[model samples]
Each structure stands twice: as structure tokens, then as C-alpha cells.
Target: MLLPRPLLVLDLDETPWHGELGEATQVTFALRPHLGFFLQAVAQAYDLAVWTAAGNDWLQAGLQAIKHETGVDLAAQAVFLWDRGRCTWRRDEAGALHFRKPARKFRARWLRARYPRERILAVDDLAANYACGYGHLVRVTPWTGAPDDTERLDLARYLLQIAPVPDLRALEKRGWRARL
Candidate 1:
């Protein structure tokens, strides 16, 4: 069976931007410079989305600048945007609710209701709390604007390797039928 286009939801803080959540005042370099190239590559196959805790204005402004500065058109593939929710801090440590992490579940409910066949792959640095029940879920290490392609490529390749594939053979066998 064929699979629906996968959703690649990325975090803006340390994953894409350099650090500090892409503030308007700070416009230096990105945490992952190769993010531009990686996003472009994935754009060919996946639907992109921005899921961060940042407000809309800040999110749009920073993303706009990134595209203008890098000429990567990072927002082109973005199909949706979701800023994480605030949780109650009354509970204890773990239970205190770090709902700030952008999760697939935030959009998963509607996604399922609308398009159940499609899946969401969450790309984040901080630990995530959302589970959208998409094809898969991914997590990248949180960075502080280091600007490296090696790590970015590794992560991107990992995403491609795991996402949009069917059955264990598509993963473990790593050959033959995958090309079909």
C-alpha cells in the first residue's frame, strides 16, 4: 500500500535556529546551518510545518529573516504552525507538565479526524510529550547555534531512512524492494 505524505514538524529553538528561540534581537547564525539544505531535501518528499512555543509574530519574523538571509525558503514546505501549550506547574517534577515541547499530538487529533492516513514526524530538541500516532516520531538533539552540517546530515539521513518506508524489510533489509 502507498503511504500519504509525511509531516515534518520542526522546532525553531535549538534545532533550527542557533539558540534563545529565534528572538528578533538576535540574528546571528543558525544552530544547524545545513538546516537549509536538509529542509530543501526533505521538501521534495515531505510536508513541512513549524511547531514551536514561540508566538506567531516572533515565529514568522524569524523564519522570514532566515529565508531572506539564507535564501533557503524554509517556510515554503510548511503546511501548518503550532505553538506548544502551557501546562499546569502545580504538579511535581515530571508531573509538572512540560507541555512546551512541540508534539505531533497537538495537530494529530485534527490530522486524524481530517486525514487519518497521513502521519506526523516531530523534530525537536527538548523532550516531547505529544503522540499523534503518525507513521513515526523523531527527535534531534537540541543545539545552541553551532552551525554544523555533519550532524545535520546525519539527522536528515536518519529521518529519510526511517520515514515513508513500509514494513521491516524497508528498514532492516535496506535494499531491493525499497527502490520499487
Candidate 2:
């Protein structure tokens, strides 16, 4: 019997798209270059999910924009679309407020049944977001409307290359771009 595909948990804001909060609560979204192609390529190797520190409204609006613009219905395809409610509130030594996506949550019975810790990976622009689960992180440079950015394209190649690894979390993902 074939084993289950690994889980690829993705971050939303500043990772896949950049959102500008316009007047009257409108949000203008700029998608990363080659986002659609990246998603299509990665989906072949893993089950996708969205985990964002943004609130529900922002998440929904961004998803709508992503669907309308890129023709990729990310929400529909994602196993789960998690928002700020799922994040842990944190304060740094400077007392600055932050929201962290605690990796320990993966130990929950429901999630572990489908994806063991070693079979899971998370892509995020902020390394701090995965402080509790550093082993699972595949850090990407933060995106903010760089028209020439090829991060996602290169990232797709990297992810595809690593998909067959038995324990994704055990792999050293730093300098992954250089590897590709």
C-alpha cells in the first residue's frame, strides 16, 4: 500500500502574496511571481494547507483575490485554512507583540494520525514563526511585490527534490536555494 503524501503547511501573508490594506477595509493583493506554477508543482508531491497570522477577514479576502487573479482556488484545495485564531500570541524580550505558529500543535491526535512530525514541513518567511518547531521549517525570503523575484520557482524545484526524502524534518533546508 502506498503511504500517505506528506503535508506542506504554508504561510499566507508575505509568503505567497503581499496585501495592502486600502481605505474602506479594501485589500489589494500582489501575488508572488510564479505562484500558480509553484503551487501546481508542489501539489503533485504533498497535501497543502494554509496557516496565517492574519485575521479571518484578511485571510478570506486574500483567498478570494488569489482565486480571481491566479485562478488557483487555494482555499478549496487546502486541507485547512487557519487564521490568527490558531496562532499563539507571543512577546519578545523587547516586549513587542508577535503571533507564532506553534509547531507543537501538530502533535494533536487528528493531525498526527494523518501526518507524523517527520512527514510534515512548513514554509514561512519568518523563522520566528516556527521557533517551537524549527526542525519542520523551510524558510523563504519574505516576499513583497518583487516583480523579478524567482524564489517560488526555485522553491518548487527544491521542494520537489526533497519530497521523496523519508523524513523531511531531518533534512537541512538552509541554503536550499544554493542546492538548486
Instruction: State the lDDT at 67 in candidate 2.
Output: 88
C-alpha lDDT of candidate 2 relative to the true structure: 0.91
lDDT of 1 at 35: 67
lDDT of 1 by residue, 53-167 (tens): 7666667776876787667665665677656442211345667544444233544566755334335566666554333322233556677755444556666666676566633
Residue-pair clash count for candidate 2: 0
Give me the runs in candidate 2 sitting further than 4 Å from their true place.
none
lDDT of each: 0.58, 0.91
Residue 67, candidate 1: Cα error in Å is 0.6
The C-alpha TM-scores of every prediction are 0.69, 0.96
**Residue pairs in steric clash, candidate 1?**
18-31, 18-145, 31-145
